[model samples]
Target: MLRYILHKLALIVPTVIGITIASFAFIRLLPGDPILAMAGQHGITPERYEILKEQYGFNQPVWVQYFDYVWGVLQGDFGISVATKRPVLTEFLTLFPATVELALVAMIIAVAMGIPAGIFAAVKRGSWFDQLTMGVALTGYSMPIFWWGLLLIIFFSGYLGWTPVSGRIALNFFLKPITGFMTIDSLLYGNWPAFVSALRYLILPSIALATIPLAVIARQTRSAMLEVLGEEYVRTARAKGLSPRRVVGLHAFRNALIPVVTTIGLQIGTLMAGAILTETIFSWPGIGKWMIDSISKRDYVVVQSGLLLIALIVMAVNLIVDVLYAVINPRIRVQ
Candidate 1:
């Protein structure tokens, strides 16, 4: 197990290097001078442009700039944002908790609702319940995230007036962010009203963000369950007169979870991608929205560093999922 873990850790080195190169190169490739962006409509004189280029190291050769960027990254300096004048890393850390909180809540909703629906659908394979569940899943998977989010906001926030249309919590509830997660912070401060407000604010965006992941998980679960149920071990468990619940839950579900776990892990990338639109639509303060804002301003430092950081997070999640394979199935550990 240690060897397997070490192998995975070692592989990350090359991937990190590759991600850094891509992040650095891709942002530079986009049309628009960061210096010009900083100048704005008033612009700057030729002398001022030359001074700014030299100050930002843009006058340096491409290779030197890349080397300097990589060296700074190694020293934990992600560069100062031209727009915000803040260290990219510092800004990212400040806002990252919100993104994590949103993604975590979204996953909880997807797993809580999706898995059981899938299990029942698999059990009743040919029934109307299965058909209806699958149809709904397909619709959810096909729907554009931006459109779905707007529809939800209209119905829930506009028409019904149940949930808040935007933001992480009600502005009226002043809860200092102890851990940066609003709900947790509310509980920590013993602010019940704030906690309730946080949950209410979270509902629509979480649902909108969860839709595709929920559909994918449900479909994967059903497929895995069906395959597991048809296996010899499941048949033997049933033949031995074990209760249906035990045979299905203990024997089949555990085995089926291997594939379902993989599907869930893969959804991290989708969640991050979908978060851009969701956060933008809902005006949620998170890394995704920050990235979008930075891109518009041509804040190359923030955009590149944010992309690299987000990719690292996704890779780390995937690593955790890989480690879970051993824990879930002893056979993998033995291998």
Candidate 2:
């Protein structure tokens, strides 16, 4: 297991290097000049432009700049944002919790609903419940996140007036951002109203962000469950006169979870991607929105570093999921 883990950790080195190259190249390829964007309304003169470029190390050879950036990253420096003039790592850490909160809530909703829906759908097979669940999953998977968020806002926020159109909480509530997660911070401060408000604010955006992941999880869970249910051990358990619930829940579900876990792990990347659209639509103050703003401002350092950080997070989650496979099925560890 230690060797396996070390191998996985070693793999991340190349992945990180690839990410750095891609992010660096991709941001530079974008049309707008970062120095020009920084100049804003009153643009700089030719000498000023060259001076600014030199100051930011843009005047260096491309290979030299790349090596410098990589070295800085190794030293835990992601560079100062061209737009904010703040360290990119500091800015990202500040906004990361918000994105994490959003993603966590979405994952919670997906798992809570998706696993059971998939299990029952698989168990029932051709029944009405199964048909309806599959139908809904298909629809959810097909729906575009931005359009879905709008429709939700129009109906829930505009017509029904049940939820706010945007933002993390009502302006009336003031809870200090202790952990940066509004809901947790609200509870820590013993602010019940604030907690409730945070939850209400979370509903639309979480649902929007969770849509694709939930659909994917549900479908994957059903497929995994179906495959597990047909195994000889499942039939053996059933033949022993075990109750349907125990047989399915204990014997089938546990085995089914290996693949479902992989699917869920893969969805972290999707959730981050969807959060970009979802955050923009709802004006949620998360890393996704921060990245979009940085992109607009041509903040090359912020964009590149932010993309690298997000990729790192997804890779880490996948690593954890890989470790879990051994725990979930010892046969994997033995192999």
Candidate 3:
């Protein structure tokens, strides 16, 4: 188990390096000059532009820039965000927890509802529940996130007027951000109003973000459950007079969870990235929205650093998922 974990951890270094190189190249190749974008309506003279380039080291060869960037990254420096004039790492860290909170809430909703819906659907097979759940899952999987989010806003926020349309918490609360997660910080500060406000603000976006993952989890769970239900162990459990519930829950569900967990784990990265669209639609303040804003301004440092960090996050999630295989099935640990 230790060796397996070490091996997986070792793999992340090269993966992150590759991601950095690709991200660096892509950001540099993007249309528009960061310097001009920063200059805004105050156009610079040719001499001024050249001075600015030299000042920001834009005049350096691409390879030298890349090497400097990598060296800085190695020393835990992600450079300054041209948009905020703050350290890219600090900016990311500040915004990241909100994304984590949103993603976690979304994942919780997906797993809580999806897995059981799938189990029931599999158990019933040809019943109405199965049909309804599968149909919903299919719709969810096929639906575009932006349209779904807007429709939800129209119905829930506009027509029904039940929830806020945007932001992490009500502006009135003004809870100082300790963890960057509104809900957690609210609890820490003993702010019930803020906590409730955060949850209300969170509902629409979390649902929007969760839609695809829920559909995927439900479908994967149903498939895995169906396969496991047909296995010899399940049949033996049933033959030995195990109750239907025990046979399904204890024998089948446990076996089926491997793939479901994998889907959930893999979805973490997608959820984080997908938060960009959802956050934009809902006006949620998170790294995704921040990145989008940075992209619009052609803030090269922020974009490159953000992509590299996101890639690192994805790789880390994958590593954690790999470790979970040992817990899900002892056979993996043995191997």
| Winning candidate number (lDDT) | 2
Give the number of the best model, judged by TM-score: 2
lDDT, candidate 3, 1-335, per-residue tens: 88889877887788888988998998887799999998899887889889978876789999999999999999999989776789999989988898999999999999999999999999999999999999999999999999999999999999999999998888788877888889888999998988999999999999999999999999999999999999998999999998999999999999898899899998998798789999999999899999999999999899999998998888888888888888778898777
The count of backbone overlaps in candidate 1 is 0
Candidate 1 versus truth, CA RMSD in Å, comes to 1.3
What RMSD value applies to candidate 3? 1.2
Model 1 error, position 4 (Å): 0.4
lDDT by residue (101-161, candidate 1, tens digit) is 9999999999998999899999999999999999999999999999999999999999999
Ranking by lDDT: 2, 1, 3
Local accuracy of candidate 2 as per-residue lDDT tens digits, 55-138 = 899999999989999999999999999888899999999999999999999999999999999999999999999999999999
Candidate 2 lDDT score relative to the true structure: 0.94
- Report each candidate's C-alpha RMSD, comma-separated, in the order given: 1.3, 1.1, 1.2
How badly does each model clash, as a count of residue pairs? 0, 0, 0
TM-score of every prediction relative to native: 0.97, 0.98, 0.97
